[model samples]
Target: AMFESNMLETKQREIVINDIDPDALEKLILYAYEGRLEIHQDNVTNVLRAAHLFNISEIVDSCCKYIEKQ
Candidate 1:
């Protein structure tokens, strides 16, 4: 679940991402800024994992759709 708006006030200003693959993280960040995903056969699984962890619904949905097409 996502954090509440007030959670940021009492918490540290930084976020740490661990466990996720670097390539996946890089692609997810690009997706966050561009509002589009480059989901492909090779990267789809890692991308989906990153999207799920980061709560990027749009990317998750896009990755799901891409998987469905396979």
Candidate 2:
């Protein structure tokens, strides 16, 4: 991995995010950084979708459990 080897890599990378809401993306990043996420009725579906796309099983499961309890 060039990024892991620190070879021939730029300092910045460009990522294009579409379809997902900005607020939901922000919350997902926050969850990734802090290892915790607070899922609520309003954002659950969006967050869950993001989690599934990103292959984040923990968040996906959390969202499912939250939905089940609702």
Candidate 3:
């Protein structure tokens, strides 16, 4: 949604996400392109939150499944 908004037409064309952890954001980016992600005990919560914030249902479901299995 950020990219779809007018922000992309701005001079910088950059979307700064300050609420999410940098590591989680990195993992989310990796998942977006790779279609795969590793959700470990330490990062599952962070990943889930980021995925939900971005409305990435696949990752959110995966994270929930991982949590249920734990």
Residue-level lDDT of model 2, residues 6-65, one tens digit each, is 554534485466788777788789997998797899999999998888788988999999
Q: Which segments of model 3 are wrong by more than 4 Å?
A: none
lDDT of each: 0.83, 0.83, 0.86
Which residue pairs clash in candidate 3? none
Q: What is the lDDT of residue 25 in candidate 3?
A: 85
Whole-model lDDT for model 2 versus the true structure? 0.83
- Residue-level lDDT of model 3, residues 24-60, one tens digit each, is 8889899878966978999999999999998999999
Q: Evaluate residue 31 in candidate 1 and report its C-alpha lDDT on the 0 to 100 scale.
A: 72
Q: If the candidates were sorted by their lDDT against the true structure, best first, what order would they fall in?
A: 3, 2, 1
Q: Rank the candidates by TM-score, best first.
A: 3, 2, 1
- Model 1 regions more than 4 Å off: 1-16
Q: What TM-score does candidate 2 reach?
A: 0.76
